[model samples]
Target chain A: MVRKRQILVIGNNTNGCTPKHEKIAYDIGSEIAKSDSVLISGGLGGVMEASSHGAHDANGFTVGIIPQDDASFANEFCDVVIPTGMGLTRDYLNALSADGVIIVGGGSGTLSEACASYMHKKPMVAIKNLGSSVDPYIDGYIDHRKNIKIIGVDTAQEAVKKILELITA
Target chain B: MVRKRQILVIGNNTNGCTPKHEKIAYDIGSEIAKSDSVLISGGLGGVMEASSHGAHDANGFTVGIIPQDDASFANEFCDVVIPTGMGLTRDYLNALSADGVIIVGGGSGTLSEACASYMHKKPMVAIKNLGSSVDPYIDGYIDHRKNIKIIGVDTAQEAVKKILELITA
Candidate 1:
């Protein structure tokens, strides 16, 4: 079987902002899974759990890039847990391995991972105003005045559609 | 002035989580700061922001290890931002530069960074339930547990005190 391209969901893992962000994050991840995309995450809680859960609920494949050998840290929804044995540096591999990236409401860690996606020239879509403590870091090139389609959308479905358009176009 | 020891806080950067987790994370960082500790992080969200803010609020310093050239991604609380321009690999340096590591609640990305900490033999403390989503992995340690301090604390204050007691002792 031809393997489906994995779309990594990079997000913030903050307790203060996660409860509200989880709703939209889950919607986007679920939409992506419903579209047959394999979900990948750092494999724990917050957006990772929501995204992993969304993909699993839709009967889609999910891969969690975990930091250690233990499976308990793997979010409950992850189908394949790959223990990186690398620690926080595993975040680098997560960003590097993805076909593209979707940045939901995020903070520094998400921003760092998103920068990785941008640096690797991977297609990226940042979901803005999802109730993160820190505002989304918008690339100047993708500003509203510009026609550059490093798309930004409010809903999950639209974000996925825009990502597909950018990738396939 | 005696320079504060830099304690690197490494872990997953998912969407913001709970205020309780943030409070715990900050409590640990603040405790470290009170001891003249300089906080370090991947320069982004979740525990990183919470910890950095805690240290900064305590009149301590913070350094953010950023993967991109732009320092805008650094949290507002960070006193200094070191742009690595090396994408996700920057996380490795964050792990390498720390005097020790305090893992707040995290996923795989945090796990990966934690692995780097372990590999380097840096003293590391996981805030029990609050640090990383290290589930089954936490249970598999048949040996070599002596080198790592796994403290199951209900609050960040205890976690910080434990980390200080271990590294300083």
Candidate 2:
């Protein structure tokens, strides 16, 4: 059986994010589904829920790695929820399990997962100039190692396409 | 039933560490086991293996969360092995699951886990003057957030005792 590619999307939670982030994440999630890849996220409210909602609506597989131990805490959109009971550390797992990552708009938590992706040599891309916390790291490396550049784009379609290309390349 | 305390040890792998680090980690592991707490680690090599070996020799429970998907990749010292198949991202899980953390000699991977622990508000302590990558954050906040401080200790016994106290307090 051919393994379906797994794509992870990281971003800000409800309070720290704007509505635009939600729309972008939703589109990215949908595009990932349309591209025949599984969608995964932190499984919480905000960008995570929005993306998962999009994927679930598009009839795509969705997985959520929640910080809480109770799977019920995951957004309703998650088809397969794994309650890690480990809190934010679970965020790193989302990055680790994915073939590539998309950063819509995020703060420290998303940056932490991004660091994990960089350390693991995973492909990643971000939506440009949304004034997101991840802006500094966009179009550049996360640190001095210069492991991989986080490609930047204008739309969710480009975001998903870029990640897939980077991964396949 | 009272839950047994879970302690996490993060540090350099075999290649980046010195023999002294191994000895220090082993002692820390033994001390934790003697304190009747479970020992947990990355389950790969160097500090992780030594700590698990110490705990196992002391007939204590040891859990190894391996970065690879193969359970066999874990050190034989591990009583329970979980292969995350998520690469370095699995390192964050070690901090999330533990009530407290101990830092020996470590690299960027360890620092990454340290960031997770801080975000989750997990208490941490490190060996002083070990020249590990985590030194900067020792006794200080990992970031401007300053959620928690990584205290400094001189010995394994002090490390174990301090963590138990911090958790109970």
The candidates' DockQ values read 0.07, 0.17
Number of the top candidate by TM-score?
2
Encode model 2's per-residue lDDT on A98-166: one tens digit a residue.
899999877657767877888888999999987654566688765545678889999999999899999
How does residue A88 of candidate 1 score in lDDT?
A: 65
TM-score of 1: 0.52
Every candidate's chain B TM-score: 0.85, 0.97
lDDT of 2 by residue, B1-169 (tens): 8879999998878766788888889998999899999998999899999998888878788999998999999988999999998777687678778999999977657777777788789999999877665665678765545688899999988999899999999
Please identify model 1 stretches exceeding 4 Å from their true place.
A131-136, A139-150, B1-91, B98-169
Which window of ten consecutive residues has the lowest lDDT sum in model 2 chain A? A129-138
- lDDT tens per residue, model 1, A22-91: 7766876788888888888988788888877887877888899987878777988999898988666677
